[model samples]
Target: MRGPLVVLLCCMVALGACRREAPQTGPVDPSGDGQVTISGDDLVIADLNWTPPPVRIEEGAEGDARARAAEALGDDDLHATPASAIPLYLALSAISGEERAAAAGLRRARIRLLALGTMALDEADTGDSIAGLRAAHEFAAVARFLAADDPDVLTYLQRVDESDRLWELNRAAERALDAGELGEDGGGALAGFRQAAALRPGQPRAMQGLAAVESALIRRAEVAGSEGDFQTAARWLAHAAEVRPGMQTVVDARQRIQRMRATRIQRLRDEGVAALPKINGVAQARQRLAEILTIAEPGDPVARDLRQRIDRAVHYGDFRPGQVFTDALEGGARGPQMVVLPHGGFMMGALPGDADAEDNERPRHAVRFERGFAMGVREITVGEFRRFVETTGYQSRAVRRGFSMAYDERTGNFLRRSNVDWRSDYAGAPAADTLPVLHVSARDAQAYADWLSAQSGRRYRLPSEAEFEYAFRNGTSERYPWGEGTPPQGSGNMTGALDRSPSGRRWGNAFAGYGDGHWGPAPVGSFRPNPWGVHDLEGNVSEWMGDCWHATYRRAPADGSAWINPGCRDQVIRGGSWASSPAQTRASWRALAQVDTTNARIGFRVVRDL
Candidate 1:
């Protein structure tokens, strides 16, 4: 009756006639759904080109099927009835094989799925949503198979998938919000709404949820402000403003928090000032200043002045024990920062039964340090020393003398090479910027300290011999800082397994079975720190102390002061250099160097009074 029906009927007739033709001479190919044949001595193709007519129910019967499907879905009550009615419609589809059958099947599946999804969303039940979505998908797949290119079927299936996803995200978001896991740090209802909005743009419910979250954050800010946590309150209001700008509540909260913050800062400032006068020592004063810094706004003059007074107290060793500082030098250069050693008493010389202990370290006597002082965390580095030279045009003793004690790896001996200075590589090898600055004399080190003191407006000098020994011992009576062990793994950088290279070959001796993975002086802090949090205190280089060289401690000061002699020619050098043997690197080992002498194996670190 229609154009498509007429074409289908004609094609069926033509295919039926073609099916009667017999094969002429070749075997038949029956590997497909259609059949092959030979027609009157000519080749005939398969019958696949013909279209089959669709089975259909009578009009009254179709009306009955549709009504039954609707009743089974229970659309009026939004509840699913027994699925026994599904098979009835499926049997009808098998008999009819019609496009309308497929459409009916899709409609029934969509209705049940939508109803179930509605229930899940309204009740906020995730399990029911999943079950309904899976059932709908099965029906949708069958409908697609029946009418693979049906536009209405494709559209309805898309809607079903979107509904499933929207409800799932909504449920999750609601749960997070209920658990109080949302807002500024981000784990709540706000995140869920954003996901939903991304899925279905312009969604009214998602937008409403976002607005609710913003309002809640604003309220939290008000509560925090009332509790005197003005900083936290401001942070919350800022998060709200970010969500929705130009809110009157946020503007009002900002003003209120600012007023509260100023009053609170002033009260804290006064409290800190009153606490300062009551602080009897450097330790108490430092504690009070640290508290003031916590609440004080940046660049507040009261906080700044309080910090200055605290620094003065530390300078005279009036501050607390265990304080550390970063004393900036000229050109804003900083090295490894300093740490304050606790004021206490310990044996100042070598321990008993130390075979490596020299005569100079004998007659061990008790040394008491009443005032705590700060020491460098690491040795002075090349970069830090270079900054001083570049800023002040200052020359080191090695540079002025045009030569220093350098090692000749080729000959395996120490030699005074011409034109050799601090910049020269260890025995003519290139050195990194982080290695300790070597070839510096005692006077040259003092000059660096003077430069630092001028730049920082504070006192900086080398630690005295007693201070060096006390800090090295770190409250231990053992031979070494880490107890009695043969230079265990990761100890201070010394001549080790890796020292068989160019300059290392020249090193007289090295620790057997110990490898620090470096040939010469490694970078400052390259090895592990000592017990006192100080790095390379025993090995990188023999550090020069403020005290002059003394063969023995017969008349040494017991007050932890430098034992300087006006006419002394050599300065006390502690902490054996990299070129020294393991025995020479012992804690009790000591050496001496001319005050104006420079050597690649010698350098120094500074200490500030605290």
Candidate 2:
């Protein structure tokens, strides 16, 4: 309200010289118009129904008044002050006409502003922090309006610098939590977050950092308890509780740890470990290990070994240890399932013992992924590709070319046919939209990726040659993903005994014993997924990769990144198509074709950065 400002102005004019000649008293307005009435030398505002003590200045009293005002504004809990004391201090400064008093008044205003701003950066209450920050800004404007030339105003502005420091501290905490370094020393992101919270209360990001750090610590404590290191586990869980008091995760973890004490954590650990080898899939093994860790003690050798095994399995694509998620495209119209891969090293090429290994698959060079990424759980199906086309009005290369290679039963091999494109099946019937879109060129695949990237606000592109092979092998050096022999039944849609139809007769060579129950491309994800939770890497259709075609790995990049030559016209293709033979279905098999090459046997999947 303007009542405070009006009172301030009236008091300043009246007290400039301590020349109060007479009492200008008026009726106390019951209407509450916030009218100020001067009674004797004291000032009163009717709305507040409050009166200030008469201003009486003695020799050298200005210093004492200024000091007292400073002490009041500098209280530890200035935020709880009933009302701002700025106007009273200003009246004192006017009556005393001392530069020190004026400066003190401004200093007090600045102190209050800083207090509000400090609360904005580190408060535990997210809503309060936001409101506090806004209030701090408003207070700053008022202080500036009161005295534009005061040096204390600049001193108060330094809080902005403190806010920046708080930001860095919060960010450090986030980085530490995300990296899983919960140590109390330099590695402790929780420590930094707490420090920031102490400096500026109620910051949302800082609170989030604390929650993540505490959760990680709780998980560690669970592991430690399982390993019989109750002391260490208790310490970590206590620390988590201290950082995020009353957090449900901390409460649950504590209860679990207590239960482990009664049941003897080792029993569960032993049971889980014994079940690991019997598990049919990596996901099952990971689940068993996770159960063991919940009661295992921190730093337990057995728990450590199990964790390493799970990590290796996940990296090799034999296990998907994390949750499967989806990314929306076309403004949430399409959500494609994806699997996360961890950063790791793997032998990218074929093994030396493989009899069917080609020369191009030689050198068995090492490849590493420095960062994790997400891959589509299956090849991009016609349904997905259709969305991209409909949204962007994109024309695939096959469509523009007016023809693409398709299986011709009469020719008993793939032949170029007019009017054949991604929309047409090999038999010239309308292709099922659920199947992997075929007759799309490498360029067309990249275009679709580009469209997806633009629509989803993520980097979506074809996987590199190494990424494809890594996912295809799925932690195995076997010729085929399933095993050294023929692929298991219903493993993929590869050309098999089932392709014996008139249309299947076109592919003269097929895996002799295998019958995937499909002659042409089966609907995406119709068969079992690879160990990495990806479907149809061995069949459905051969996928285009981002790498430029290379005859050998003589100079290929050691990192799992695409190796592209700007001038190259051919791109690499991996994962055999449904028309491929047993040897062609081998994981290490690689092929090169013109960038614009389109065929019913070729389709693609996509990769996104994590």
Cα RMSDs of all predictions? Answer: 24.7, 26.5
For model 1, state the Cα shift of residue 457 in Å.
0.8
lDDT of each: 0.65, 0.68
Local accuracy of candidate 2 as per-residue lDDT tens digits, 399-461: 887888887767666888888887877555678888888889999999988887887788899
For candidate 2, the TM-score is 0.49
| True-vs-predicted CA distance for residue 395, candidate 2, Å | 1.3
